[model samples]
Structures are given as structure tokens and as C-alpha cells.
Target chain A: MKKVLFLFVVLFGSCAKLDNNLYNNDNKIKEYKLDDYTGEQDFILDDSYHIPPGLVTLLTLPSQADGESSSTEIKAIYIGDVSKINSDTVLLYCHGNKDHMDFYWQRAKLLAHVNGKNKYGVLMMDYRGYGLSKGKPGEKGMYADVSACMQWLKNNGLNNNRLIIYGFSMGTASACELSANAAPMLPDKIILEAPFASVAVMIQDASQLNMPADYFTDLKIDNAEEIKKCDQPLLWLHGKSDNFLNYKTHGQAVYKNYHGRYKESILIEGADHGQVPSQMGFENYLKLIGSFIRKP
Target chain B: MRLIRFICIFLFLIFICFCSPTQLVKPLQKGQRAAAITYGGPLIKFAGAPIPIPFTTLGFSYGLTSKITGYASLHTTSLIFGNLQTTVGGLFSLYEQENKFGLTVSPAIQTAYNIRNKTGFRIWPTLDLNAYYHPLQKPSFVYIGANSWFELSSLRAHNEPQANHIIPNIHAGYMLVKTKWQHQFEIKYLGLGIPNLPGVVDYIGISHKGALGIYYSLIRKF
Candidate 1:
């Protein structure tokens, strides 16, 4: 018994000292400093675009895990009137995995414009390890960052009845994370743009093989599987020619498999991954989104 | 939900191991050879539900010298279309006592390929320390062992992190004695470890909980 105990200790003790890099493969997350070149004041809209005035920058919001506060604080932007947030509809726009808010400035401006030119509010934030947020980006960390932002909006009198959630590209994972699982509060509706089913499905699509789940990162943000549990109104928009994430395998899969009360999808022909809104025409895009929001 | 999916996969891998035949616990004499076929699966519990998946394997061992043996095996899931793993190993006896107990150490390397469509490959290096006790009868004996493996290769290209590298397994079982037959049933377990590298835990997001398995085997000696 003593020998067995000693052996167990030796074996388990050695594992704790093993290198950390051995387990992670192809985790190509690029963390960058916040782009100070662009600011709230710099977002001047052209005649084609509509800009909202409040455009306030949220300095830092705390991320909590298991009820303990994480050291990382997130940065975000609110592109609407703070006073109108209580009365008007608000859209929390979760952006894709890229540089930061600067990369998504146009999308936020467009979403605000989509919301009847500042009649509604648009909120956007950088997940931890993305922009000015501290700490590395974990699945839970990003979830916590988004949750903090949602909590902040709720604290400011933005309720679920007037809140819409929109996700684009990698941000779909964060959006699905909130919806498939229970949050502090649910959204009135969900909008997914060029969403992938899951990381495994995406890899399989990329590699063109029936790879198993947990094949790569175990980052099981399986939107296809998770969406079945969400019972909210959903709006899906995708380009027919999206090369990065195939519309049929990802977007259509999620939409087709969604067991929601109300759901709709729009597939624009000849539009690629990043050019859906452009190809669909801004006026038409606004009309579709506006109808979804104003629906009884 | 993510946690449930992670647990399901982790447990499935253990089920695959559970279906595999036991490695040669007793060192073979010169000119002796043993071949076996195994079948088993895991009883998995997740989200208050139980799931069992079938697994199978074919294994063989040959004695090169009085105290050394070479072994190899092929294993798959559901008889087809999930994953296929091939393993090669050598065992050298360090100590032996007739009608009593013996000790041996084995070092093995294994490579697994997914067979569904595209080929995904991973490699693991394993070391086993085993002890066998023979009270009076030679073939009807009991054994205990532990195997530790470090993942040396991944399915993804370009140094992306994979989940759980140091796989530690423990086993114990009794052998059913027969002249030309090697039959055994064993209990096995693979314990989970913490993610030591940056980006590993974030990507894998699996808790450090181990899996328990039940295994059985039948072999022919020549």
C-alpha cells in the first residue's frame, strides 16, 4: 500500500511540472494594444452613414469567474443616447475576432443606423485579450466580459424587452454562449451574421473531413448543438458566397436546427463573408432588420 | 453545455481504452507467442444520463529472448468510422520469482488516426510499470499496473494547443488459466490533468476529472 501511494504521488507530482505549451495547438489568438488613433470624436459619419451622439467609451468593466473577480477589466463603446437607452430599443453588437473596436466601428455605426438612425442604441465591446482588456482570452473569460457589459446595460435601465443581441463571425460564439446557456437576463431576439456551427464543424469544413468533436481545441462552442436549447426569436443573415465560413454548412445548419418560436434567414447571392451588408444593399438590410425589431 | 460535451469526448476516449486487451503481464519464454482479441466499452454518465459506446481491438505479443517481449495492437470504435489507433511496445522483465510475483517495465509508442474522412493524426509516448502475483497456479494469476503517457503530437497543424497531454492510467485484473487460452478481465482508469500551457485550458476548457473503464480479453498461445 505504501509503495502504491508513493508511486501515485511521484506520477501525479511530475505532471504538475510538465510544460504548458505541449497541449495547445494552433491557437492563433493575436492580442494587441488598444488602437488609440481612433476615438469617439473621430467617428464622423459621411452623408451615407448616420452617427449617434452619446458615443461614450466605457473605461473598464470587471470580469468575474465562479463569483470571484478576475483582474482583467474590459473596454466598450455605446453609440446611442444614454437617456434614451431606457425607453428605446438597444442592440448589443458582439464583433468578430480581429483587431478591436476600431475594426468594428463601421459595423456599430451601421447597426445604429439600422436602428432608425439613433432611435435605438448600439453597444459594442472588446473581449478580454482583444483590445484594452487585460488577461488572455478564454472561452469563459469572453463570456464573462460580455456578461459584464450586459449587466452594465441592465444597471442603466436597459431591460430584456428592449434589448436585441447581434453576433458576427467569431462573436457568434459569445452570442451563442449567452443564449444557449442561461444568462442574468435573456434577449428579446438574436441575430447571427455568417455564423459557424461550432469550432469543430468549422475545422471539419476547412479540412474537409468528418473530424470528431474535441479534435483540436475542445473549444466546444457548438452553436448547432446549443441553438436547439434556445427558444427565442432568431434572425440569420449570410452571403451565399461566404468562403471563410460556408453559409450552408454553418448558417443554414443553425437556422434549420433552431427550435425557436420564431426564426428567419436571409442569404444574399454573390456576396462573400465580409460583404453581406454591402452586397445586400444598406437600405434593404435596414429594412429587414427594422422589420424584425418592429415585429409583434 | 460546453462542459457536458467536453466530458462526453473525454469519457469516450476512455471507453476506447477499456475495449482494448490487456498488455502481456507475464513475460513470455523463448519461442513463445500470444495473440488476443478484445471487446468492451464504457458506461458514461453525463447530464444525469448514461451512455455506453462499443469498442474493439486485436493484439499480439512475441518473445524475442528469455526475458524480453515485443507487442503491438490495433484498436477502433464501433467496429468502424470513428478512430483507429495502432500501438507498438516492448517489455523487459527486471525481476521474477516462480510461483510468487514478478515485476516488469514497458515503454510504448502509439499513433491514432481518425478514419471518418480526412486523416487526423496524434502520437503518444507511454511507459508502464507492472507487477504480477502467481499464488500456486501459473496461468491463473492476478496483476496490477500503471501506465503514463505524454502527448507528443497533435491533430492540428502549426503548434496549436491540444487538450490533456499527460494521460495516467491504472489497471488491475485476474487471468483465467487454460492450456492454449489467455482470458482476463480488468478494471482500468485514466485520470485527467491540469492544463499547464498558456491557451491550453482556454481552448480545451475541460475539468480535471478522470474516467473509469472495464476491460476483458481472450488470447491464444502458441
Candidate 2:
């Protein structure tokens, strides 16, 4: 027993903690490169949705993980007049994994045009460790960062009934989590684009083996299960042929699990993980989202 | 999920290597006993460069009869991280032409259980057939074989119907025998006829189909 214990210690002594940052791609970039960026992109705006440089305001909000002092400041960008946020219908756009805010700026800008350009105020933020945000990124920190953003809007006059939360890819966890159990303010509705089912699904899909979900220590971002607890309306959009996260196993699974107030899903044919918006057509995309958000 | 990257590596290893690389294709004499250890996994671009996952396993083999060998192994790499896994099997010699060539079949079962996730026991049935040649007429030889595993559970994430059931691998290897030790090297084309791209792991495969795997083994005889 002593020898076995020694062997166990020696073998796992170097194993690192499963930090929440493992689920995010914040370490992939050293700085934020917005429109000037030229890398892999799912949606590219050809200046049609472009707002003047001053139109989008970059603001830093103080936020922290659950239980810790909320001192970490995160970067957020907003479209429309800040003075009118309290009276505005705001769309909180959470981005996918990879790089920083610049990668999803086009997507956020696209959401700003959901019901005609600049009609609904759109706010998107870089969770800690993403873009110019301080500290590192993790699951709890994600919720806190979003709560801080919503708090800022509430302080400026926005009400819960006019707030909509949207998540893409990795951002889906925060979206579903916050909506399922929001602290400062609950979103009126939730929108998920290319959302995954859960960590269990991802492991089983990639491996074809039924590795126990508990084997993954700290990584517990399960949107499929969390959506079940969400009573708010949900709008799910997924590509028919998503290679990263399969539509049949991931998106459909999440869509089917949500027993919410109101729910609808769109399966875009010939589209993969990152091609949902482009393949769905920008006009149709905006119309679908606008109609859903505009609905009772 | 970076953890998905870890799980994918483990899954890739299941198709390529739940046992030792020296699945010799030749049965040992009655009363013969040996111990073995193996290392290596499907190559992936981890932390920037291409490298094997360094999965490790320790195994023991015993000749129950002249034509039947019993073997079992533990995936120590996984055990170190809290998941306990083992593969158990028997080698049945089907045919042999003295020392020139021989055929053998190994039917195995792999089971894994996590200490934290108690009751979450998972099992997969595996089978391998190898045909080996003794080129030097001594203890050194080469072999080629096909290995496969069956995923019995029909439910995937969120109870989705599991579409895929069997994963196949084609492998070839060489073993060098010494007085009391043996050294082996093997290469496998894992998940044969299956596409292996658009994933977190950059598997080294052929035409984007199936992953190429390399393994090394050391064995001690008693």
C-alpha cells in the first residue's frame, strides 16, 4: 500500500487543475485585432453594417467570479446612445471561442441591425482574459462579467423586459447559465447560435466512448441540461452540417431539452458550425431574430 | 473544451491501442510468462507541435496452454488521473507453419470506471487478428493485423441515438527478442475508412481518413 501510494503521488503530482479557462480560447491572442484582422471568420460585414468609429463605445466594467470581490475590469462595446440604454431594447451578444471581441464584432454589429440598423441597442463584452480584459477567463467569471454588464445597463435605465441575451459557441454556456439563474437581472429571451449540447456530448461524440461525465473535474459547462431549467423563451439557430459540434447530437439535443415558455429552432441546410448566419441569408437571419424578439 | 482534447486522445487510443503493441501473433509455450509496458498514442498538434499523447499501459501475459495465452492490462495513464481502465483478453493460435508464419486471434473487453463518477461503468468489446512472419527463424519477427472495437451503448449525449457502433484499425509491427527482454515497434491506421479531421486533434492520417498511430513496447520474460 505504501508503494502504491508513492506511485500514485509520483504519477499525478504534476497534473494541473482543470481551470475554467480550459473551455475558452483566450490564450490564442496577445491583443485585440478588430476590423483590421484577417483570419478565419464565419461572418464578414462588407461595410453595409459598418457604424462610424465613434458609434461603438468601448467601456470597461468591474466584475469578478462568484464569491470573490468584483474588482476585475472587463472590456465591453455598445452600439446606440448610452444615455438611452434604460429605455432601449438591448441585445447582449456573447461571442464564440477564438481570438477576441474583433472576431465577433461583425456578428454583434449584425445583431444591431436586427430591426433596422441601430434600432435595438447591442452590447458585447470580452470575458476576463479575452481582448483587453484583465485577469483570466473561467466559467464563474463569465457569469459575473455578464452580470456586471447587465447591471451597468440597469443602472443606466434598462429594464428586464427589454433585455435579450444571445450566445454563440463557447459563449452559449454563459448565456444559458445567466438566463437559467441570473442575479442582477434576468434576460427576457435567449438566443443561441451554434450552441453545443454539453461536455458529455462532446466527449462521447469525439470519442464514441461513454466516458463518465464526472471524469472531467472542473469543466461543467452543460448547456443541454441547463436549458431544461430555463423558463424564458429561446431561439436556437444551427447549421445542418456542423462539423465542430454536430447538429443532430449537439444543437438539436439542446433545442429538444428546452421546455421553456416559447422556443423555436432553425436548421440551415448546407451550413457547418460557423456558416449559420451566412447560409441562412443576412436578411432572413435579421427577420427571424427581429420577429422573435419583437413577439410578446 | 481542452478536456475534450484529452477525451479525444483517450478515444483515439481505444481504437488503436487498448493492449500492448506486441500482440505477437504467436502463442507462447505452456508455462511461459511475460510482463510488458507500452507507450505512445495518435500524434496530434499539442501545445503547437505534433507529438504523441504518451499514453502508458502495463500488462501481464501467461501461457495457459500451448495454443492459448491469457493477458490483461491497465491503462496507467488514465488511472493516474482518477479513471481506472483495464483490457483483458486471450490469444488463440489458429494456424502456424512451424517458424515461418502463424495466425492468432485475440478477443478482448475494455472497461473503464471513474472513482468520482461511481456507477458510471463503461465497456467496449474488442477483437484483433494478426498474421506474423519469423524472417530470421529465431525470436525476431514482423506481423500485420486488423483490430476493432464495438461500442455497445446506443445512447449518446442527451440520449441521442448512437449512429456509429464499430471502429476499425489496421496495424503492422516488428518485435526483436533477446535473452530475457523483447523490444517492439508498431504503427497503426486507426479508425480505418473513417474521416479524422475538423477536430481539436490534428491526427496524422492518410487523405484525411483515419488517424496514423505509432507505438513502442518493452517486455520482460520470466
Candidate 3:
């Protein structure tokens, strides 16, 4: 009876699943709007947050050919001088689930001004299947895609201590995954903004049922668990009223689970999933992030 | 346990993709037994194609007295996903007159335990209220009713206050009764009067509030 029951559970558990391909909106990109590109933005920046004419460079990164992830080329935008990457404190910005890099350009440009305009470098990439990248998006592909850009940064002079990974919304998965696993290399520090706890948490919260995520998806992303394995200094920020990924359930879980070297939490009131920076006041946001990096 | 405002954002779960319609609209005769198989759920746009999530169930009911009927059913689809989902309830005839209008209420407890995760044991108190009209002397009835599934846990993953406590659904059905067999066809508007907007299922709802669910049942009496 035990054997039969176990077999039944296994069969039933794997019976149905929502197609994994539906998760990515990669094909939704019209064009990569950097500066002059005006559609909709997080916030229209004053000339202060602008990246000078030639500072932003677009490049294609090569992801590692590992069994867990597909080998693919990735599109990334670097916002700083390539010649000074060795000495600069570079921040790798992992974007949320949305169209492409263009939608996140305003956020990226704002980060470039952290501490001061172009005080440090920043790199943003559209994971595979997003933007002009190749191949389909998968859970493993997300981390591997970020690793590709990391490889680019490493080959061009960025290293462990100077590398900071920042994730927002869906981007937090790859950021926390890569940092926890420390596969390509370890980051000096990590920042998560409005990070969801896990696929199970999202589905359960969304449905208001005790639904196991495996019932609908095969994706096994768990930032709450992943953060525990990370030993680097962490800065976690979330909006108090984040409607999309409720901070209390998602971000708070990740924040509390971090047994890292150090950690900080910033909960801004009335901000939503994508409005943390604007809600914190760009300067205060940058100051908070900049101070966290400069600490110890 | 804190009661938080619930929003049915995930529209596809119903067709609760858990609450269907009233299984026993009218109490069976004393000492009678019946079994049923049901299928169909909310219509969702998947890959640009409208698909009715095929939620299935197998249920059995027995009448203890002329005025009361008891039932229990397993959600076959949920089981396939390693979630043991079942609802057990008793149907009570509230108001009745032979071959005329009748009101019945089935208050059931919906239970789900995840065998795969080995966690997520949840029991929801559910109520189904229906008023039916026996339009024909040949044993057929048309009914309209409302269903509510109450979430017992006021907290969800990460100790967050569960926003949704009572999930509401409205349905209409027609039952055809024969001597040995019966069939029921029900159409449910799950999550009624709630703003289930920014939908995940692309639910075919009214004013972006709720999903349209259709159910079919076949019952054999013994």
C-alpha cells in the first residue's frame, strides 16, 4: 500500500503543468530605447542622471555552455567607460519581467548616478529570449544569462570585490541564484528590490490557496532559500504597498532569510513593484545604495 | 488569523478551479445512493486559444432522510497535480413543495493536502445555496444559486495576512432526472462581484470581474 501510494503521488504530481514558455515576454520588444527614446518611463530624469553621449555601449555577451542552461548569446548595455572597468566599482543590474532593456533604461541611467554621475559603472542585460537575445527563457537560463554578462565584465577587468549584483522584481531570482551558487564568480555585495520569495509563494499568494507551484510550473526559484546560502553583504529594499509582489510576503521573507555577512532592509511606503526608486526619491535611493556599498 | 481583503487575481483556479456548482440541488429519497463524474472549468486564453481548463471530479452521495443528502467528491485534476482535493457536504432542503419551487443549501468542507510537497494541508468551509423550479412533471429542474468557499487560514506563505478569505461564485444549472440515471449541466461565474482585473487567465468575464465556468455531471442512482 505504501509503494502504491507513493507511485500514485508521483504520477499525479507530474500530470499537468502550464507551459514553461509562456513565462517569457521576449518577443514583445519593439526597439531598445536608451535616452532619446520616449515612450513610457519610470520617471523622466533631469539632465543630472544622464549618461554622457559615448558612455553607454551596447554589446553581445556569450553565455556558458553548461548542461543545466542552454548556450546562447546575450544583449547587454554597459553604462560607463570600458577602459576604466578594472578600477571602477561595477554594478550589474538584473531587470524585472517586462518587455526589454528599453523599459528599464531609465532605471539603469538612474543607477549610473549612484554616489555621483558616472561615479561607478553599471551593466544591464536582457536575459535570453528577451530583447535581442537568443533562445527561449527558462529558470536555469536566467542565471546563466546573467553569468554571461558577468563573464564579459570579468574578461574586461571587473573582479570579485568590485562586482555588485542588483536585482529588481523578477531579476532578483537570477541575482540571488547566481550570488548563492557563486558559479561564474562571487559578487562582493548584492541588492534586491521588491524580490519575490519563491514560485510557490507567488502562486499561493495570487490564488489565495495552498497551491504547490509544481501544479502549474516546473520553475523552482526560491530566493528565500537561496539567500541563506549567500555570505556576501546584502541590501534589500521593498515597497510597503507593493501590489504586484506584496513586500511583506515576498521581500520580507527574502530579507529575513538572509544569514549573510551583513544585510539591510528598506521598506518605502506607498511605492509599488516598479516604483521603489522614484518613491525613495532618486537621490535618497542612490545615497542609500551608495552608502551600503561604501560601508566596511 | 487576520482577515485580509481578498482579490481573485488568479482567475483560472476556478471552474475555486475548486468550487464548481451544487452537486445535490434537491435531497434524494431516503435510503437512496448516487454517484457522479463531472468535468469542465473556466475558459482561459492560452497561447491565444480559448481553452476551458478541464477540471474533473468523481463524487458520491447518499440520502440519510428525505430532507437531507450527504456527498463527497475528489477533484481528479487536482489529484493529478499531487494535491488531494475533496469536498464533503450535506445538502439540506430549506423550502420545498412537490413538483414546484424549492430551495436547498449544501454546506461542505473543502480539503486539500499536497502529497508532493508534503505540506499545504488546507480545509475550506464552503456553502452552496440554490433555488430550483421543477418546470416539467417528467423530472427536470432549472436552478440558479450562489457558492462561497471560505479560506480558513488567515495567513499565507511567509506569515503574510491572506487577503482573500471568502471566495464567491454564482451558478445556474439544469438537471434531467431519469429512473436510473441523471445529468446536470451548470454554468458558473466564479469570483462574482470581485475585481479580478489584470487577469492571468484572460478570463471571459463580465466587466473584468470573475471567470466564466461551465460544468457537466453524470450521475447513476442505485
Candidate 4:
């Protein structure tokens, strides 16, 4: 009797049909509007209460992959000393699922200020449906947006040797996908923060049960599977106390699967989810990141 | 004692199979029929009191009249090991106006079973009320409703259990087909409890219903 009851509870709890009503509304996509702020005056500090010093420039990258009629726009922030663009290494930062690029502006600034004498450029962009970007955000739309920004960087004379990719949470999947399909030019290094093993694994972890991976979102980008194909140096950072994305299940899986030249894993003791870098103090975290990048 | 246990088991099985508030109503016409079903589990939270328990239910319904309909549903809850409670009831629609407005009333009876004492039976009485609206030209609609239940049996812990609750259901969907067939999705907050566990406590509950079923007439013609 106990066994039967346990089975019943598990069956119902694990696979409750997704509440389609929450997403059925047609108003999921809204036009992006810039928040009122002084021109480049520590916007991140104002928005998220984090103070990092750098020259922040707002840029828009147009997406033409969806044909001439497509009006999709990609909103991005370029952070660094604008005068030293020709010699500085560029970091393309991709944020997690919840908010827009503005949420990570402070982090980008810290990345730029890591090696003070040696300048670095950091560019963070909003996926479609987030912030000032156009249209609803989905798997295909996000890939197009990132590709457009990469092309924009290439056109402006930034090449593989001077380019680094940093992705967090959902953006880690995008970073891995791009790295696997890199053109003749590839990124110098890839950093994943709070990365997941794969889409199927994430869904199963969230549901707390076994669900058929095939029935999930039609576009499946398995980062764990894709990371094996890339030879780039990979860095993964995760917090041990993260309850939302279990460290052992998602983060550990990626670390175990990456068969690359150089792979580094940092497990913060008390950090939770997106709080690792911030909790460690910006300067100390920046120093660690700088040493990792400049290591021979 | 053995005979009494057999009779109780047979009656309980009959209640599980037949008695319910949301059930399919046979249509009067031949082409298509429209019906609605509603079922809820036991209250997990009661104001400052929180109880860790398992409560669940399943309801299926079919349409009978073009504007007027009928339904039946079943509710089951497990308060403790070896003691499972169940409620069975049926409902009828008084009137409906071309999906514009509707009024319905339901009556039900509930029973409890003790696995240790298979011969015991306890029954109770329940009532429910509903009102629904859908504009002819607009893509928006609303439904306001309520329900009550009263225990009729003389069990130590089961006497005169009364509940008064309300439901406000709203829907917005493009008419994929004319009145006969339309793809519809609805968001409803069925407020099922009073100030102190009066109905069913549902502050953190939200229901989203979407269906791709066809709507046809039975008795009443346009």
C-alpha cells in the first residue's frame, strides 16, 4: 500500500502539465524603452546599486538574418576605454535568463577594469524581448542576435586572438552553441557561470523528476554535448549553495563533460546563484579573472 | 459483520463511479455539444494554520442543452493513513444566452471510509452556484460563481460542514471559427474560502484552461 501511494504521488507531482495559461497571452513582447539617466554616468550603480568605473557606450546591432522585412534590433552596451579600442582584448558577456543587459552592466565594468594598465573591452547585449531589443525572445531569435553582434565586432576589426566569450545561466547554452559552430575565427576563451548541463537536464532538474527530453522546447541546444567539440579554454564558476540550479546536477555535469585543452572550475563556499562574484568583492574577483586570462 | 462490510464496499465503489459534480451531459441536438468541468482538492492552508496533507480530484463533463447543460464531478482526499474521504456530486445549468450569460446550481453528497472498519459509512450534503459571460463580438469574457457544502451525517468529526466560495473566470481568445468552433483560453481565480476557512483557501492558486474542442447545438436552435 505504501509503495502504491508513493508511486501515485511521484507520478502526479513530477509531470504536471505546464500551466499554458501563464504564457497564452499575446502581449509577451513589449517595446524596449531606455530608462531616464544621465549620459553614461554610472548607469549600473544607479540601476543595481553597484559602482564600477568605466566608459559605457550604448550600441544597437541590426539583425538581417530574418530577411529584409525583419525589424529585429539588438541592444548592447560597450564598456571600456573607448580610446584604446585598437589594442585592447574584447570580452562579449552574455547574461542569464531573468533580466536585460542592464542588470549586468556593473559586472561588465568590473571585467573591463580587471587589468587596469592593460585595457579590455566588454560588450553585453540584451536578447530579443528584453530591454530595448525588438520582438519576442526565443531560441532562434537569440542565436541570430548573438551572431549579429559577433559579426559587428568582426567588421570593426576585432578578431579571435583578442576576443573572449563569457556566458551566465541560459546564456551559457548560447555561448557553447556559438563556440561549436565558430567560423575560421574562434574566441580566445569561454567562461560559463552557473552553467547547466543541457536543456533536457535543466527541465528534469526543475521538475524534480524524469521527463522525456524530446517533448521539451523544439530547439534543443545541448551545451554539455557541444562543449566536447570545442578546443577553447573553458572556465566554469558555480556556488555550492544554489538551490534553484543544483550545483551537483547541472554545474558538475558540464565540468565532467568538457574535454577541452584547459578547463577550470571554481566552487564558491557560501555563494548562491548569481551572487558568487559580487559576494567575493569586485576587486578580488577581478584579480582572479585577470590572472586566469593572462596565465601562460 | 462480513455482509455489512460487503455492502459498504459496494456502495463506496458505486459512489466513486457515479456520484460527481462535473460530468458529461448528453446533448439534445445531434451535431456538437459544449460542456465545462470543475474540481478542487482539500484546503492545504487555513489562515494561520498549515496542514501537510494529500488532496486531489478528477472531473469530466459533457454538454446537454445548447444553452442549458448538466455535469458531475468527484473529489477525494486523504487526511491520514487508512482514512480516505470522498465527495460525489452533479450540477445543472438553469439558463444560458448564446455564450453571453449563464446560471447554474449543483447539489452533492460526500462520504468517508475507514480502511480498518470497512463497514462504516458517512454521508454529507453540498451545493454550488455559477455565472458565466462571453461577449458576442469581443474577444473577452468573464465568469462569477460560488459553492457551499453541508454535512448531513452524524459522525463525531463530521457535522454541518458549510462553505461559501466565489470564482471569477476571465477569457480572451481570437475566434478561430464562428460560434460553432473557436480556440479559447481562460484564466480563472476560483476564490473558494471565507475569512477563516469558510470555503476553500486559495490565495496562491491560479487556474488556466485552454481547449481546442468544437461547439455545436443540441436542442435549442439559432
> What TM-score does chain B get in every candidate?
0.76, 0.88, 0.88, 0.45
For candidate 1, write residues A163-229 as lDDT tens digits. 8889987788778779878776688889999898876655443322233444334355778777888
lDDT of 3 by residue, A1-296 (tens): 99986776678875655434335354555567777767556777888677787999999888754684546888999999999999999999999877678878999999998888898899999988887887777777878889888888888988899999999988999899999986766889999999989877867755666556665556888999999899999999998877678777788889988897899999998887688999999989999999998988
Candidate 2 — which pairs collide?
A86-A157, A86-A158
Best candidate, TM-score-wise? 2
**Model 1 lDDT per residue over B1-222, tens place:** 433444344333334433444778877888899988876555465556544444567888999897899999876442233345677998999898876888999988776665443356656677888899986856589999988776543532212234444567688988887899978887766443432111111112125234455677898889
Summarize candidate 3's per-residue lDDT along B1-222 as a digit string, tens digits: 000001122443433444463388989999999999987777666555665666778899999999999999888777865677889999999999888889999999888777666776777888999999988554888999988878777676656677778888888999988889989999888777665542234566688677777888899999
TM-score of chain A of each: 0.83, 0.93, 0.91, 0.80
TM-score of chain B of 2: 0.88
Cα-based lDDT for every prediction: 0.67, 0.78, 0.80, 0.52
Residue B80 lDDT (model 3): 64
Worst 10 residues of 1 chain A by lDDT: A17-26
Candidate 1 Cα deviation (angstroms), residue B93: 37
Regions more than 4 Å wrong, model 2: A9-21, A27-33, A38-40, B1-24, B45-51, B116-119, B195-199, B206-209
Over B169-210, each residue of candidate 4 has an lDDT whose tens digit, in order, gives 222222232454333222222222222111111222323111
Q: Write the per-residue lDDT of candidate 2 for residues A130-162, one digit (tens) a residue.
A: 878887877788888888898888988999999
Ranking the candidates on lDDT from highest down gives: 3, 2, 1, 4
RMSD of 1: 16.1
Highest DockQ model number: 2
Docking class of 3: acceptable
